[model samples]
Target: MKLWFARVAGVSASQMLMVAVAWQMYDLTNSAWDLGLVGLLQFAPSLLLTLPAGHLIDRLHRGRLLATCMAVQALCALALAGASAQGVATREALLAVSIVLGAVRAFQMPTQQALTPLLVPREVLPRALAFSSVGLQGAVIGAPALGGLLYALGAGVTYFVCTGLFAVAAALCLWLRYAHSAASSEPATWHTLLAGVRHVWHHKVVLGAISLDLFAVLFGGATALLPIFAKDILHVGPWGLGLLRSAPAVGALAMSLALTRWPVRRRTGHTLLAAVAVFGLAMLVFGLSTSFMLSMAALAVSGAADMVSVVIRQTLVQLETPDEMRGRVSAVNSVFIGASNQLGEFESGATAALMGPVGSVLLGGVGTLVVAALWLRLFPALAQRDALVQAGTAEPGGRARA
Candidate 1:
């Protein structure tokens, strides 16, 4: 419970910080390029530091590490607040802080993922993951609006609020108690750093699940073109664009709640593949729909389908991995997630430029469908797997569950 609240508050604080930072940057420079640079600078550190951070997570105490991350984020928020209050916040300062946040996130993400299985029994992990998604989706939906409201009061006020949230989250993390201990002390070397990559490469089920998300989202994402759809095709303006943006998260939150109530218990692999296929079908509907209502519905369905896939994939990965290696394996999984989202946006933009928006979306949808079909044949072990917890695997908490 402490972990759940910590995750919600931490995620909410992070989202609010992003909104305030982006608005502050735009207010100062009014340059789209500068805004894009902020995002790039933030992402760059994750690419460089995540693997090493994962190694440290395995060797150190995860809860303490997460608390430290939140503390650093709190300090960053305070710095931004101070700068905003002094009317001295600059583009350069924002860019540098973004790099710091990115680096902290590289550690925070894997620590959070690796810590969950330690806190919960393996039998309830699927439901716990589903419940966790509910909080995340809610924060993703609500925090930005809260930040915008707080920003109207002042950017300093928004930052102050974020600082408070981070502090509270850090306190919660510090309060958490779990049974798992850190891995045995090992010298940091190339072999240890690359273990995650090697593990993923050799574990065909993990490889299939993670890569499926990478390719599926890489081809099927249409978020980059939402503005185009709202203005030209739907004729709904900014208000409608906001709805389109929120629609998927709304669907995901609802689906997560359902999954928590009645978790997937059988044929988990086939279920994951079907969910991805449904997501493709939803994207296809969204691409072809002329009605705003239809488009909104399609996006909602896509979100719900994607939620199913997320719950299954995360549960599978956590259950398959031993406690000692969870941090490293989760780091590899996070990279796949980050790549799919970043590259998916780029793919959507590039294809939108070559073909029209509708055509690009249609192509992406078809491509996603084809990938789903191909993966069924490509990963037979995953497709035929019957249970989320294998018959005789050791759980992260160290007990073997049948």
Candidate 2:
């Protein structure tokens, strides 16, 4: 539990840095497209390098690898701080630094996920995950409000503080101890890489789980465009922007804690779909609201709905994956997550540029709803399977019966 809390602190710090960057970039450029570009730059390296990083995790010590990645992330944060201090805060420089951070993330996320099973007892994995996620919520709730305050101080100071936080996170990583899984006995080859891809793509359950998140988050994530709404529509400043960023985390945190006491035990598939649908509706309400309080309320509801989806999706992934293949599979999972988030940002920015921010957000909500309905109709096997299926006990639905 202590280890999980430590990991959560690191994750929360990283998220704070990310939110700070997004808010700062929007302030600097005053352009929604530029804000979206930050996500593209930050996630581009993960999209490109995560597969290779996963392969490396399978062949290396995950603990050492995670520690190394955190070190690099710290350096990237410091470099960004230096760049900002030097008054060299060009869009290109911001994009470059973001890419460097993304490169670090490519390995870090998979290593962290794969490392968790090593740190906790099998029966307590779910609880550990919940605890880790709660810390992330803490960051989400506090970081942005603090980040926005810090950003109001100056971009350079805000980045320097983030650098310091990441440095602390690196030090924390060094304190964690875990045994590595055996190095891949198989030779590192293109065929081996392809085999990992084949395994995830062909697995109906994995594919469905990743796809569900991909489509829902891709279309439903209007939170990425918050700065625009906060500034242009709602007429709120950086602090309100931070509050907007934190709303979903608030919702997610509440739900995560509630579930810790009463975990999701049945109808997982139907629940996930319903949660996403509610998320979409919440987003639509957020998009159209002209009142500041109304916007905040709507965003909070969206956050709550998103929390439900995250729990269900994570439970599905952890319950089904094999120990040996976790690294590679988690890499694929990172790609899907990164694509949905980063690409969704790009889409939001582009659409906002073309059709105005309110219109773009509303359309995204509608699209999320459409995707959920389609997924439910098309992926009947996934829709039917509501509980984790043990390897030997997989049913026709590809999961164990609840």
Q: In every candidate, how many clashes are there?
A: 0, 1
lDDT of each: 0.83, 0.75
Query: Highest lDDT: which candidate?
Result: 1
**lDDT for residue 233 in candidate 2, whole number 0-100:** 87
Model 1 gets an lDDT of: 0.83
lDDT of 2 by residue, 1-402 (tens): 434655655665676677667776776788888878877886888988866887887788766777787678777777777877887777777778778877887888887777776666555555656666777887788888888888777777777777677666666666666565468788777776655577777777667767888888888787568888888889988888888888888887887787777666677778878888998999899888999888878877887787777766665665566666677777888888887888788888888899999998899999989988988988887788766433452111111111
Write one digit per residue (lDDT tens) for candidate 1, span 232-346: 7898654465467667877899999999998888898899999999999999999999999999999989999999989988988898888788888888887777656644655
Candidate 1 residue runs with Cα over 4 Å from true position: 20-40, 79-95, 151-157, 180-183, 222-244, 285-295, 349-363, 398-402
Clashing pairs in 1: none
User: How far is each candidate from the true structure, as Cα RMSD in Å?
Assistant: 3.8, 4.1
What's the C-alpha lDDT at position 148 in model 2? 81
Off by over 4 Å in 2: 389-402
